[model samples]
Target: MIYSEKVMDHFQNPRNVGKIEDADGVGEVGNAKCGDIMKIYLKVDDNGIITDVKFNTYGCASAIATSSMATELIKGKSVDDALQLSNKAVVEALDGLPPVKVHCSVLAEEAVRAAVADYYQRKGIEKEIPGCSGNCSCCHLHDEHCGGDEE
Candidate 1:
């Protein structure tokens, strides 16, 4: 599989490829099963602006490029704006991504959302987890409502 030149450039010379030791928030996503993992670090200013963003990823070239480009795109944006960034935008910014590798961009987007959510959580705000709203089954099941077993 040949990656686009844009993807190759970013992957070969990834920007913001390290961590922010004192990041305001950090997000980690994906797992062994998914064959990709991304860790994002963010530094937000008092005005809710993202003064800095960075990522460390273990995955394919597209995943690395997406993570790198996504951080670069959000570094100077407000947290809210950064959170609104979609995988499509990231893929488009990189020109385009192949179908099978599109999920890498999705992972990058999710990592960003996860980081912003972590920031809000730290600030005592509620987070809207995708597909798991309002006292999710996991929450109810683990909170003694199920009496430790379900018949």
Candidate 2:
């Protein structure tokens, strides 16, 4: 599979590649079929800005690269802005990935949403994460009102 230069760069030199011991929020997502897993850690300030972000990924180069790029894109951005992050944006930032590897980007996006959702839960804020399955460990909301994009 052909990989973009950006993808290769990120794979070789991933950014924010460790866990935050006291992270305010953490998210983990995976594709069982592909055996790819991504875990994201976030530290949010009192102002609702993401002060720090980190990730750990286990999978192909695309998975690692996407995770790295996702953290880089959201750092220092507000939680609201981070929620706007999509797999398409991650793919675009990486120049592109093999069609088969696109799912890695999707996992990266979901990981971000899951982390933000966890943040909300910790803060006692009632919020739903878009695109979340509501069945995942990252999302503690187990009600009929969970999951999917808001209309």
Candidate 3:
């Protein structure tokens, strides 16, 4: 299969490749079956500005490109604004991903949202999240506690 030059460049020399040991939030997504896994680390300031972003991913070329591009797109953005990022935007920024590889971009978007959501949860501000009704047990559960009522 053909790959874009940008994709090749990113896959060869991905940016923000390492983990943040004490990140403000960390998000991990994708399963082994999908052939891609992404972990995003973010550092947000008191004003909710994304002061830094980094990622570690294991996947194919398109997945690496998406992770690299997603980090670049979110760093320095407000948490709210960063949460607005979509897979389409990442794909567009990368000059378009192949149809079969689109899932990589989707994973990137989900990783960012998960990180931001974790940040909101840490601050006890889940209600600020768009579309969150603040009623789920997951919203109020304390750190290290599981209140989802699954059991």
Candidate 4:
């Protein structure tokens, strides 16, 4: 399959790779349909802005690209603005993905939301992530990530 130049660039040299031991939030997700997994780490400042972001993904090129692109999009942005990010945006940021690989972009978006939810969970705040629940096409694409077991 033909990949976009941006996709190849991000896949070959993904940004924000690795974990943050004291991160304010961390999120991981997978796509069972293709065994693609993604992990996102975030450092949110007291003002509720994302001071830093990173990701580690084990999957196809699109999966890795989406993860990299997701981190770049959210870093330095407010948590609320980050939540506004969408899978479609992720795909578009990567210059688009193949029809079969669109789910990877969805996974990227979920990784961010899941990590933010984790931050809320850690803070003892009960939060709800819209477009994250129910039987949406992207929601159906999830594989749990907090456990760290790759599938």
Candidate 2 residue-wise lDDT, 1-68, digit = tens = 78999999999999999999999999887744346778999999999999999999988999999999
Q: Model 2 clash pairs?
A: none
Tell me the number of clashing residue pairs for each predicted model: 0, 0, 0, 0
Candidate 4, residue 33: the lDDT equals 49
Worst 10 contiguous positions by lDDT, candidate 2: 137-146
On a 0 to 1 TM-score scale, where does candidate 3 land against the true structure? 0.83
Q: Which of candidates 1 and 3 reaches a greater lDDT?
A: 1
The C-alpha TM-scores of every prediction are: 0.83, 0.87, 0.83, 0.86
In order of lDDT, best first, we have 2, 4, 1, 3
Tell me which of candidates 1 and 2 scores higher on lDDT: 2
lDDT minimum window of 10 residues, candidate 1: 132-141
Better of 1 and 2 by TM-score: 2
lDDT of 1 by residue, 1-151 (tens): 7788999999999999999999887877765344578889999999999999889998889989999999988989988898888888999999999888887887788788778877777778776656223222222222343345544
Q: Candidate 4: TM-score?
A: 0.86
List, residue by residue over 87-137, the lDDT tens digit for candidate 4: 999998888898988878888888888888777777787778876641222
Relative to the unseen true structure, what is the C-alpha lDDT of residue 47 in candidate 4, on a scale of 0 to 100? 88
**82, model 1: CA deviation in Å?**
0.9
Better of 1 and 4 by lDDT: 4
**Candidate 2, 138: how far from true, in Å?**
11
